[model samples]
Target: MKQISFKNKFGYMMGDVANGLTFGMSAGFLLAFYTDALGITAAAAGTLFLIARLWDAINDPMMGVLTDKMFRKRALKHKNQKVDKFKIYLLKGSWPVIVAAILMFFAPDGLNGTQKLIWAYATYIVWGMTYTFVNIPYGSLAAVMTQDPVERSSLAVARGIGGLIGNILPRLIVPLVLVQFTDELSKGYLIAMILFGVIGLVSYIISYYTVEENIVHQVSDVESTDKDGFVKSIGVLVKNRPFVAVSIASIAMLLGMMVNSAMAVYYFKDNLNALQLMSITGLTGLLPMLILAPIMSKVVKKFGVKRTVATSSLISSIIYGALFLLPSNAILYISVSFMAAIFMTIPHMLVWGMVSDCIDYNQYLCGKRQEGVIYGCYSFVRKMGQAFAGFFAGVGLSLIGYVPNAIQTSQVLWGIKFLTIGLPAFGMFIAFIAYQFIWNLTPEKQKEVVKSINM
Candidate 1:
């Protein structure tokens, strides 16, 4: 077996960091940008999200088919070849996704109504499609790199460390820039988003060049059995127990995080009257990710993935719930919440790699390798979860007597409090339940599965 090096691991980690930059910023800021910055009503934003996501579900499977076909064609052309097919296709085709990511964040001025919605729909949907294009293959690259469980665990830690920097640093600093750059929040957010979009494009390109795929699994070159094979792919994935569990868990986690992101912005600006504290509080939340991520391999080895996630989720839930009952001092809230975030960051840093582990387990059980379908389904669930966050947050704000661009009311402040604190705590509880009871893949079982897959 070839030894895993810092160069190879860091290269793969770069792609993950780029992934975090694109998706994390989108999730963190898009709804706020739409409502507060782009002059869209919260209800309309929710409706837009519901409609666009309903339409966008088609993109995920289409991407899976597209990636699979590309892989198949590469194999055919390079038949009996020593070179890895996925790596070549990745190097050649990753640019479209990067371009699409940049375009998605480019919201020009001097547009109204239909034009604005059109821009949002076209850019956002295309970005989602492009994200699927890169992610399916990028995720598959993990298993391709190495079969050793220890090394894969190490890789997971390294990738998380890189991701912590990519994800946490921007979010922590962007708010400070926005607070300083423009008197209007929207204009500030717009500039910050564009900057992030450009950064995302650059990082994605760098990652594409730096990373290489090392292993290729051989599928039987039989005649195509069904023209409608994508449906079959979905069916195969549904039957995968580990896939289903991890998918549910990921959905819950993403939904909670998105709601928190939107609410955190609201809470800082509206409730606390400490908008600039957003930058400080964001830094506090991110601290654990930066410091603890490199050591995640040892943590997971000692505690195991399930215990690690479950413990973190539970601790976060309790703290989030208690935040509702605590005194609303900015310093006090920030202090306690940061400690909670330290524990909470573990799952954020490490869970996708756990999903990768689940994919390996599924392959071991089913006697088939379907990373594209499994990962595609996983992304579909995550996007759906994001959609729910947008929808719920809009409705939650509406119920809380929140009227945009209006003066403060005690009731409206209460509503913001509920959404920011109560909703996410509930979501964390749901995640805890899913992972603690639903996920049965322990480290020992994962080792057994890896052994079987290699055998």
Candidate 2:
């Protein structure tokens, strides 16, 4: 097995930290920002999310194809020089995303309702596209960095830890900081988002400088020029059973994680009577992931990724479902949620390495590598879940007659409870079904594919 240094591993972790800071910001808080700060309707905000994500679904595959073509051109031009296909995007794309991330939250301070909506549309869509520009390459980077399964699992753990830090740190600090700036909430969001954006930019640069792409898979000249190459390649991926199953699982997994996140403000504010409590709850909930992330590779070695994810999903489903029955006491809410988060974290920590395995399975089947395409396709499916979650959070709120700053009725409170807790239970249960039945890339099968590719 090839060895990767701690520095290289840390740099790899930073890439996902970059991803989580921007994405977690939007996923966890953007909908609330829209309705509360800008006076956008819950239905309108949900529609905005759905429409933007549908556009992203179109963008991911296109970016995948473009990335592969660009890498080949650069490699051919610098035949004698070292040319890293993925890092080039990371190096150049960081600033555009930083700018986009800040602008996405800015919303221009004062605009009529329609104009604010338009600004939201333009900025968020641009941010999503720019995010894809970096995210696809970052996701693809791991497959090239190491061909060893053990090393890839370690990389996945590093990424999960970084993402949790990026995600959790904001939750801990943002609510507390926002408390101090409550008189002007919009200004608070803009200031908070700007800080996260700059942090994201620095992490991206660290990742760009630190990672070495040790394995380069070259595209043959004929394959590059084939008129139908992209389409044909996608067809191959569709036929790759493990890839298809995993992609389906991605959709379900994101759906659960996101719905829970998107509805968190409602749960904290309406159900529990203090939005500030989110910071403490988030810190407690994340403790298990903090404990589990460092030793996750060993956990994977003992139990295997597929089995681990499936079991975690099952346990998390039960715990979150039970949360739907707990009394509204904050102590009980925090404690049960803390236990549930332990299981909620395992699948996330291991899912990316499982994705890298799908890449190996692709090469084994076709004798061709398309890491960018595969990762992008997987991301595209995952975005469907995101799209639906955004739509669901909005529509679900509307259906329950949620008023942004008013005391919710018991009926509305129940809806908030279901949206935050019960929906995730449903989402987790579906994920359990997907991985337990749909995913077939057992460790034994993965070993066969890796051996076949090496041979």
**Highest lDDT: which candidate?**
2
**Which lDDT tens digits does candidate 1 get at residues 1-455?**
78677787877777766776766666667777776666667777777766766556556656656666666666667777754634554455456766665666566789997787788778777777676767767766776677665577777766776666666655687678767754576666656656666665566667667766666656342114124377776776766666676677666776777777777777887888887787776577657766786677788878888898888888888988898888666787788778767767777666667667767876776565655656666777777787788777876776776776567698888888877777767777777887788788788888888889878
lDDT of 2 by residue, 149-223 (tens): 789998888888888878876777778767887777778888888898889899999999999898855546324
What 10-residue stretch in candidate 1 is worst by lDDT? 219-228
Task: Mark the 10 consecutive residues where model 2 has the least summed lDDT.
Answer: 219-228
TM-score of each model, in listed order: 0.90, 0.96
Off by over 4 Å in 2: 219-228
Clashes per candidate (backbone, < 3 Å): 0, 0
Deviation in Å, model 1, residue 244 alpha carbon: 1.9
Q: Pick the candidate with the highest TM-score.
A: 2
Off by over 4 Å in 1: 83-109, 181-187, 219-228
